[model samples]
Target: MPDKQFAPGCGLVGTVKLLDIGVPTTNLGAVRCGEARAYAFWARNAVAPAAYQILGSELAKIESMGSYSCRNTVGTSGPVRLSGHATANAIDIGGFVLKDGRRITVLNDWASADPALRQFWDVIRRSACRRFGTVLTPDYNAAHRNHLHLEDDKAGFCR
Candidate 1:
């Protein structure tokens, strides 16, 4: 299931779809065309290139919290602006599943004791900053303590 229409009143303005990028995921995560491309590009240019050096294996799946929802930003109460998720313009990557059968989650490994994991995490974050306009990590706030929020809003925010 690549593309689907959001239910009426989902706060989306156009067509949205889950990306099928030839990689396995724990579940389907919806994203816009640009986001999909960014993910693919990151996988190809960042993850794969450093997989062996960091994880001693090939890159596998990217575990994500998925995308597309009619909701406000996390930690916000009422009357908040719609987040990129509301329009399928963002992705929340929770972890990376390596081909060596190692699962590295952001919540668990962002500050791992192992030097390789820490380095890998930072590298991915910086790489994401280069590609996405808004890249929020756990350091940004407690609300983002469990995932790397990548959005292509071109707002020039990378924290």
Candidate 2:
């Protein structure tokens, strides 16, 4: 088991844990420190409004794809190198489900949803750009068609 954490900045406040923090690249996915901050921000800022707007309530929890990058997207056809997770700068967040039994998943219903949902997602995505150094969504490219990628790159660029 990894360290259990309760991050305050993350609206989650009391709900955070690490299954494993220092596992090897082969055993555990790469994760970064900056990415953790990005995730906390996403849960606190973006996920909250998106939930209240689309699901009719604030989200109870944030589903995450813990950060760390040992390598970039597969099939890029190049030599293997450091992934976003290695720097702990990028995180792949799946989505959030509200306390009211409503779900807001980036993969399942971000774009196909109704106007309120679309607006909610848009607002959150744009807001993330302000909090994170780089924010990428399904529209940024096919690479991010499945999840919301938030990062605090040293370069200070946003997607």
Estimate every model's Cα lDDT from 0 to 1.
0.79, 0.59
lDDT score, candidate 2, position 85: 47
Specify the poorest-scoring 10-residue window by lDDT in model 1: 7-16
Error of 1 at 49 (Å): 2.1
TM-scores, all models, native as reference: 0.85, 0.68
Query: lDDT by residue for model 2 over 36-71, one digit each (tens)?
Result: 555555666566766776658866666666664345
Scored against the true structure, residue 146 in model 2 reaches a CA lDDT of: 74
For residue 59, model 1's alpha carbon misses the true position, in angstroms, by 1.4
lDDT of 1 by residue, 34-112 (tens): 8778877887788776776877888788887977787778876678677888878888889888888998898998878
